[model samples]
Target chain A: MHDSPDPGDRRDAVCVVGAGASGLTAVKNLLELGFQVDCYERETAVGGAWNWRHDRSPVYAGAHLISSRPLTEFPDFPMPDTWPDYPHHSQVLSYLERYAAHFRLGEHVWFGTEVVSAVPTGDGGWEVTTQSTGGGSSRTSRYAALVVANGHNWDPRRPTIPGEFRGRVMHSSAYKDPAVLRDRKVLVIGGGNTGCDLAVEAAQQARQVWHSTRRGYWYAPKYVLGRPADQVNDRLLKWRLPLRLRQWLYRRTVAMTTGDLTRFGLPEPDHQPYESHPIVNSQLPYYLGHGRITPVPDVTAFDGSAAELADGRRIEPDLVITATGYRPRFEFLAPELLDADEQGRPDLHLHTFARKHPTLAVIGLVQPDSGVFPLAHWQSVATARWLRLRLTDPARAAAVQQKESAKPLASWSKRRVVKTERHWFEVDHLDYLRSLESLLNEMEPA
Target chain B: MTAFDLLRFEDWTNPVPPADREVVSLLPEEDDGRPPLLFVPGLGHGAWAFAEHWLPHAAGRGFPAHALTPRPGGDLRAQVHDVVQTAASLPRQAVLIGHGVGALVVARALGRYPARAAVLAAPVLGGWSALGSALRANPGGTLPALVGGRLSLSARQLFQSGPPALTAEQITGYLSRLDPKPRAELLRRATPPRPVGDAPVLVIGSPDDRVVARPALDRAAAAYSGAPLMFPGMGHDLMLEASWAEPIDAILDWLTKQIK
Candidate 1:
């Protein structure tokens, strides 16, 4: 209710939307730089997606961080040593709460408040409107800059089929328990990590399980040589082997461990290993081999409790769960501000700063193959430093902005082919991390 | 009981049996079927290796599979004789599937016996280039196995750093079950039979195989005029590897076409 200082007096203030990992990091970095911050979160608590208890969270009962804890945790605040290598969603939420308490970030955040809309003012600033979740009262405030960190997993992209089926159908976001699959023939569609996990769970309880995938994916075990796969990848990078030799060694290792996936009736992966997001599920092959789960091709159409496959096979299932993934939705901001590409991915410099408006930035928008927390942390730091540099030195800010604008989108995206809409914002974790480090280095105060 | 239980050594005093060169048969559900499939192991490996997964899979697919375990103390000639004798005992012509040094025995034995078809999975054709690559990849294992009378290779060398699905305990258990081979047999230069005859041959190779290079496999396929099928990312142990079914399926498809 306008209890803070006048917007004109506090021109160095920044408004952060969404109190998620990116939002919390933005608040911490902005406050550390002595910038007054106003963070708005629709939820009553911190830990946006990790807060599995929240109604808006897409996390399910079986959800766990695909990346290990060490890589996912903030560098300044490491997860507890007692936590498992792959901590559950609840543990992640707890770790986020601990991070907020350690940095006193909750004080800067406005809990139970939603940012209704944010529009760029003509004077290189932002006109933000917020409303409390409890009351419908709207508040207008002006800020020197705006950081959108609302994340991209809330809106489920449910694909429409040509025909209708006489079975219970729901998106993976609506699935919370394996009880729905008990004693029923369940068809889990999609070859992503979520679909694999759900298929593994249903294999044990469902009367029959049919897994459908449109394309093949490289599946890696969670552990390699008794250590996490991501950790092994880091160690391998330090080895400094030639790219060809490294790829050969990695291919050999994967073949030895995962065996030939084609034997399990799945199609051969169309791309090389690590070329895209790998499905890291160890139990998938085991279940497929044991005949507890059957792998099928993509669904071409549905015929009353039966689904027709693209390969000319049909399956009669009692229920179907679509783990088809989510689309990046930023409805709070106007469409014109995004300048999205043909794939609907926003044209941001280094996946962070806007080319037209350097004052407006987006953090944690990438779907990297590995942990996103460290990447998000570095991105927020770069953004905060850039904002400060823009205010203090216009020439240097313009130079940095020019370089970012010239950066090619092809260099940022490494996929040979983007198969689905969900992969539109995908970034190779190692490449993106290096780019972030360089951007951070360039943004350092002279 | 596991094949290891039967072949388990009591101590140094108790020597292995000489008559243990008998063929171990894994018949399918039906009594009579098509020609049975015969599997031959490479250096330092026993019939138990194929028994792990391949034999059961082939038997389940209605093709009775058999593994030929050669007598302990023998040269390459004697090993080839053992394979020939085992094939003669089968009621009908059998499909020959050989791996590593066993492939050499199968190549020699095919000249003397009648086989429905042959599937060579990572065959060691003993060309200088192929031997050079094998030695470079695994000097510690390959050198000792060739020079000395004992075959010594670690689990890492055997499975090419071990498969992911198998735990350390499982690998150790498998390693414990392995028996040493006669070095003279593994080191001897393989002389390909004058002509491989009219028997259809399928040569399966792994491009990433460290033990058996693809060049040697290519040469073997060329010599036999066989259809060469290469699995791009697979390692040497095609039968025991996670994707063992790929080669199995290929062999099955070839056999189906041949029979028709």
Candidate 2:
């Protein structure tokens, strides 16, 4: 499969897509594995999320991570303990920068290169196509191993608001800081964590803040009783129990653990065991309690300053923050390798390696309340090991792929583990790491 | 419990006593077992806060329920210790619930004991961070230490004097049950560098919350990689308010969906 490196090849050679967390990890690990690697990042700099500052950065410019330092960090590499429990978006970006530098991943990355297409060539190798993010440059290269570490948040998902809204409207992804909504009547849409956080922040600065949710939501306080709510809830749901009983228990447990909606001027939920919103903290209710924000109904339509809700209520809003979630963006890929379900999300197998092909692997695709770093780290390790095996021992690689292929795509939570069903790729970071290590061990020659 | 034991936890207070160590008593009858749901309370609150709000609602809705409170009486740290003790005693792997300052404690606990789902509500994140200072400065008694660890009865009586927006009576009863030490200690624990777990998170928040604020919860949830449930009308005492049932139900519903 050696097509022949140009008579003079100065570039050290493994192709990595995107220089985000997973991509960087793969690059670092590849170096550790002693392979010459080439990393292709669409962004100009090494930091992915970090580089996407509100002004110049793309993808989660205003967004901060939900994962904490200890859990967000790598197994061997620990983040500074001094960082807050929940670091700001900038801090995370900064941390990624530090990680890249420490691992020396910056030197190998081609900052402006974005992978446009990848095809498996003869001899089980890959031919890659690229477009420059800057200078409009285009090029093609071939690599023995390909690691697609392009993160999941690359694409933006806009909601189909049944009716048009005339008020100043923007997606949560477009929201950078709360400074833009000063003194205006702001309506924050969506029941997700970002919506809640933005609603709360806007409540303080805007003349009025209206948060709308179609589904009844649970405002999970960061702490319960005297600890973080996740710890308590996770503990309770981590068993073999009836789903009904578990839901019941979860309701009672959270209620006892946190405060009620009245404190925030919001209506009581109609449903039991309200769905968990991925909000960062629980203290948001206090802002509502103090009359800083108002919780309204789902927006049905809007005409200028006034917006109508599904509940038949109309409220005037100066601005509307549609923190409506996001979708996966894989525009650069060819139709053959890129297949998405009805939701437009790439139909990944185990959420990592592409289902249709094994040579092409995807990492950091799973969305969790905790940070993707842990998962990304383990995924990179697994992909690396798998690639190594495929290169040295194709038979073993084929066998492993066959077994992975045999497993059904939809499998989940024998216990109360919450993960996307389509991306049934959730793993306990620690367990996944160990499993990856074992897989790596099996690949070594005696 | 001794102070050191309170610090070490597990050794001093076991959520479930040794005698209560039963194997798999609460398994789901039909579906494959999801992780257990463990609920931890935020600062100045106890498991009773949730029970008062959820129990009546769950019963009305025909949902079976249980609320683990701070086993009758103890200091703040002791109650927190007891909570950890009692929670660990339950079946392994449950969704953990934490609110306000309590979210930090649960984060630490999860750091020690990994769970299935982590739902942090209106969290204060690290109460000692740059933003936390502002929250601590607010007059919500979140900073009970500023008034000295021991608040006078008249001063302590003021939290109830404010309004009926929340079930003040329930909040009062909850406050009357607390001893000074754990309250201060609990607040102190809500500082930066709070522990974290790798479980999927469902964060609940309100923009108008005064004490903990949305920024704190936002940052905390962001750290956890959790999905958020934001509302505009809720107050800091959400779990205890009249509108609390909806959010509580939402959390439970999400847990079921998540595990399924």
Tell me the lDDT of candidate 1: 0.76
In order of appearance, the predictions have TM-scores of: 0.62, 0.57
DockQ scores of the candidates = 0.01, 0.01
Candidate 2 local lDDT, residue A403: 65
Off by over 4 Å in 1: A1-10, A414-418, B1-260
Residues B79-158, candidate 2: write the lDDT tens digits: 44444444444434445677765666566555434345677777756545423433344435434555665432222221
Runs in model 2 deviating more than 4 A are A1-12, A54-64, A162-165, A231-249, A260-277, A410-446, B1-260
Please write out the lDDT profile of model 1 over residues A1-446, one tens digit for every residue.
33665643347689999988889988877876668898999999999988877777888888888887656766444465446889998888887886676556788888899888888888889988888875798878889999999988888878688898999999998888888989999999989999999999999889999999987777888888877877676666546455567667777887897678888899988877766676889889889889999999999899988999999999999899999988777877876687876545787777788777878999899887667887787778788888989888989988887786676777666555446566667786666776766666666665
lDDT of 2 by residue, A1-446 (tens): 22334632323356888887788888876765557787888777776655664233444434555544544655434444445555777777776776676555787887777788777775556777777775575667777767787765535556566566666788876777668888888988877677877877787678888888765556656655564454444444344355588567656765675556655546665554523324555656677667777777767766656888777988988788887666666666664464675555666655677766666777787655455776677667667767777778888777777766675533411223423332233443333443444444555453
**Docking quality class, candidate 1:** incorrect
Q: Please state what fraction of the native interface contacts candidate 2 reproduces.
A: 0.00
Docking class of 2: incorrect
lDDT measured at residue A358 in model 2 versus the true structure, 0 to 100: 66
